[model samples]
Target: MIYADNAATTKISDKAFEKMLPFLQEQYGNASSQYSLGIKAKRAVEQARKQVAEAIGAQPAEITFTSGGSEANNWVLQGVTKLFKGEDIHIITSSIEHHSVLNVCRALETENIKVTYLQVNKNGLVLVDDVISAVKPNTKFVSIMLANNEIGTIQPIAEIGKYLHGKGILFHTDAVQAVGHIPVDINKLHVDFLSASAHKFNGAKGTGFLYKSASVDLPNLVFGGKQEHGYRAGTENVAGIVAAGYAIEENVKEMRKTAERLQAMVQTTVSEIRERIPDVWINGNAELRLPGTVNLGFNGVSGESLMNILDLKGVCVSTSSACNSGNDEPSHVLLALGVSEEQAKSAIRISYGKYNTIEEAEYVASAICDAYSKIKSAI
Candidate 1:
C-alpha cells in the first residue's frame, strides 16, 4: 500500500521499536518507584528527556513528557491562563491552528479570557504584521502552530518570536508537525512553550513532550503524584518515552537526506497528477511547505470520494486532520485561508514519509489521475 498520510501518523521506526521493547518486557518499572528497577526506568526517562531537549536545543529541565501534542497544547494554553486569572489577558492565535489549540482557546473564552483568532493569507501563512497589529497591552500570550497540519505551511515563527520578545508576551507553538521533520531550536524560535508528538516523527504513539522555557511559570494541568517535576503529574509512559528519544535522535541524524528524497518523490507525484488534472491546485505556498506534504484541491471532485477511491486502490490519503475524521464539517484551516466551503471540501492531503519510494510516488500519481478521470466521466 502507498501510505501518503504521514501527516495523520507514521509507522513506528524499527530502531525506535527496538529501543522501546525492553521497557515493555523485563524492564517494566514505574519511573517514580525507588527500587533499582525503577531507578533504571527513571534513568531511561531522564535520558529520553535529554534527547528530546537536545533535539530542540532546550535544557533537559525544560522538557516535560505528556500523552501527546493535544495534552501539551492544552496544558500550555490553559495553564498559562491560570497564571493571570481575573486579569484582562488576551491571546493571539491564527485561525488555521489545529483544533487542539483553537478548541482550547474557545474553552478559555467561556472563562472571559479574550482571544484574537488571527487570519492567515490565501497561502495559509500567519503574517508577522498581522500578529503585531493584533497584540493588545493585555495580550499575555500567543499560540500558533509552527507548521500547519493540513496544508503543511511553515509559519513565520522566528520573526513573530522576535517581535513578541520585545513585547514580553509569552509565546507557545504547537510544533507537532514540524519538530522532527525540520530543524527546531528553542533559542532560535524564541518561544516560551512548545509542543511535539513522537508519532508524527516515526516514534511510538501516545508519547510527546512540552518545552517550557526556564523563565516561564505556569500552573499544573494535572494533579496527582509527583511526576514531570511536579508540573505534569502521572506515571510516565516509560517505553514510549524511550522510543521517542531514540526515534528523534535517529530522524535528526538522517533528516536532511530523507527530506531531500521525499521532496523529490512529492514533486514527481504532484507534477504527474497535475499534468493530467489541469484544475488541480496546491492549497498552500508550494515553495514554503513541508518537504513531502501537499494539500491539493481537485476542482469538481469530492475529497471524501477521492480518498475512499484511493483507499480501495491501496493509496492511503486523508481529506482532513485525523482528529476530525468523522466530522463532516468543512476544514476550519481552509476556511481560515478564505477558501470557499466547496473548495475546502474538495481538498485532499498527501504527506510522504522517509519510507516512501519514488516508485510508490509515481504509482500514487497515476492512481490519483486515473481515479479523477473515472470520477469526472461518471458526472
Candidate 2:
C-alpha cells in the first residue's frame, strides 16, 4: 500500500527500533529503582532526555516525558490554571488548535477561565496582529500550535512568542506535527512550554515529551513517586523513550535531505492531481506549510468517499485529524478558515514521509485522480 497519511502517524524507523529492543527485554528495569539494572535504565532515560533537549535547543532539566502529545498539552494547559487559583485568568488560542488544546480550554471555561479563540485567515494562518488584539489585562496564557495537523500550516510562533514574552504572558505551542519534521528551538520561539509526540516523527507510539522552560514553574498533573524531575509521576516507558531519542536524532541528522525529497514528492503529487482535475485546489497556504503535507479540496466530491476509494486502491489518505475521523461533522480547522461546510466536507489531506519514494508519490497521485474521477462520475 502507498501510505500518504504521515501526519496522522509515521512508521517507526529501524534505528529507533533497534535501540529499543534491549530495553524491552534484558534491560527491563524500573528507572526509579536504585539497583544497577535500574540505574542503567535511569541513565538511558536521561540520555534520551538530553537528546530530545539538544534537538530543540532546550536544557535537559526542562524536558518532561509523557504518554504523548495529548498528555503534554493537557499538562501545560491544566497545570497553568493552578498557578492562578483565585484570580480571573484569560487564555488566547487559535480556533484551529488540536482538540487536546481546544477541549482543555473548553473545560477551563466552565471554571470561569476566559478564552479567546483567535481566527485564522483563509490560508490557515493566525496573524500576529490578531493575537495582539485579542490580549487583555487578564490574559494569563496563550496556546497556539506550531504546525496544523490537517493542513500543516506553520504558525508564527516566534512572532507571537516574542510579543507574549514582552508582555510577560505565558506562551505554549503544540508542536506535535512540527517537531522532528521541522526545526524547533525553544529559545528562538520564546515559548514557555512545547508539546511533541513520538509517533508523528517515526518513533514508537505512546511516548512523547513536553518542554518547559526552566524559567517557568507549574504544578504536577500526575501524583506519585518522582519520575520526570518530580514534575511528572509514573513508571517511565524506558523502551519508548530510548526509541524516541534515537529516532529524533537520526531524523534531524538527515532532515535537510529528507525535507528536500519530501517537498519534491509533494510538488509532484499536487501537480499530477491538478493535471487530472483542474477544479481541485489546495486548502492551506501553498508555501508556508510543512514540506510533506497538503490538504486538497475536491470541490463537489465527498472527502470520505474519495478517501475510501483511494483506500480500496491501496492508497491511504485522511479526511481530517485521525482523532476526529469518525465524527460526521466537517473539519473545524477548515470552518475556522471561512470554508463552508460543503467545501470542508470535500477536503482530504495527503502527507508524505521520508520513506516514501518518487514512485510511491506518483502512484498515490494517480490513485487520487482516478478515485476522484470515479466518484464525480457517479454523481
Candidate 3:
C-alpha cells in the first residue's frame, strides 16, 4: 500500500526496534527499583531523557516523559492552571489546535476560566497581531501547535514566544508533528513548554515527552510514584523510551536530506494535482508549511468519500485531524481559515515521511485525480 498518512502515525523504524529489544527482554526492570537491573534501566531512561533534551535544545532536568502527546498537553495545561489555584486562569490558543489541546481548553471553561480562541487567516495561519490582541491580563498561558497535523501550517512560534517571554504567560507548543521532521530548538523559539510524540516520527507508540523551561514552576498532573521528578507518575516505559530516543537521534542525523527530498516530492505532487484539476485549493501557508504535507480541497467532492476511494486504490490518506477522524463535524482548522463548511468538508490531507518516495507521491496524486473525476462524473 502507498501510505500517505504519516501525520497520523508512521511505521516504526528498524533502528528504534533494535534499540528497544534488549530493554524489553534481558534488561526488564522497573526504573524505580534499586537493584542492579533496575539501575541499568534507570540509566537508560536518564540517557534517553538527555537525548530528547538535546534534540530540542533543553536541559536534561527539564524533560518529562509521558504516555504520549495528549498526556503531555494535558499535564502542561492542568499543571499551570493548578499552580494558579484554577482562579483567574486564562489561556490563549488558536482555533486550529488538535482536539487534545482544544478539548482541554473547553474543559477549563467549565471552571469559569476564560479562553481566547484565536482565528487563522486565509492561509491557515495565526497572525502575530491576532495573538497579541487576544492576550488579556489574566491570560496565564498560550497553547499553540508548532505545525498543524492536518493542514501543515507552521505557526509563527518564535514571534509569539518572544512576545510572551517576559509577560509571565507561559508558551506551550504541541510539536508532535514538527519534532523529527523539522528543526526545533527550544532556546531559539524561546518557548516555555513543548510537547512531542514518538509515533509521529517513526518511533514506538505510547511514548512522548514534555519540555518545561527551568524557570517555569508547574504542578503535578498525575500524583503517584515519582517517575518523572514527581511531575508525571507511573512506571517508566523503558523499552518505548529507548526506542523513542533512538528514532529521534536517527531522524535528526538524516533530517536535512530527508526533508529536502520530501519537500520536492510534495511540491511536485501538489503542482500536478492542481494542473490536472481545476478549482482545487491548497489549504495552508505555502511558505511556512511542513516539508511533507499537502492539504487540498476539491471544489465539489466530500473528503470522506475521497479518502474512501483513495484507500480502495491502495493509497492511505486522511480527512481532518486524526484525533477527530470519526467525527462528522466540518474541520475546525478549515473553518478557522475562513473556508466555508462545504469546502472544509471536502478537504483531504496528504502528509509524507522519510519512507515515502517520489513514485508513491505521483501514484497518490493520480489516484486522487481519478477519484475526483469519478466522483464529479457521478453527480
Please give the lDDT score for candidate 3.
0.91
- Of the pair 2 and 3, which is ahead by TM-score? 2
lDDT for each residue of candidate 1 in 32-82, tens digit (9 for 90 to 100): 999999999999999999999999999999999999999999999989998
Q: Which 10-residue window of candidate 2 scores lowest in summed lDDT?
A: 220-229
- Where does model 3 exceed 4 Å of error? none
Candidate 2 structure quality by residue, lDDT tens digits, 1-379: 8899999999999999999999999999999999999999999999999999999999999999999999999999999999988998999999999999999999999999999999999999999999999999999999999999999999999999999999999999999999998999998999999999999999999999999999989998788888898888899999999999999998888888999999999999999998989888888899999989999998889999999999999998999999998999999999998989999999999999989999999999899999888987898
* Colliding residue pairs in candidate 3: none
lDDT tens per residue, model 3, 1-379 = 9999999999999999998999989999999999999999999999988889888899989999899999999988877888888368789998989888999999988988898988888898889999888888888899989999988989899999999986867899999999998999998888999999999999999999999999987888778988899977889999999999889988988999999999988988888898889689888888789999989999989999999999999999999778888999998888888889999999999998999999999998899999999999999
Query: Which candidate, 1 or 3, would have the higher lDDT against the true structure?
Result: 1
Taking all chains together, each candidate's TM-score versus the true structure is 0.99, 0.99, 0.97
Q: Candidate 3 clash total?
A: 0
Runs in model 2 deviating more than 4 A are none
Please say which candidate is ahead in lDDT: 1 or 2: 2
Model 2 pairs in collision = none
Report how far off residue 107 is in candidate 1 (Å).
1.0
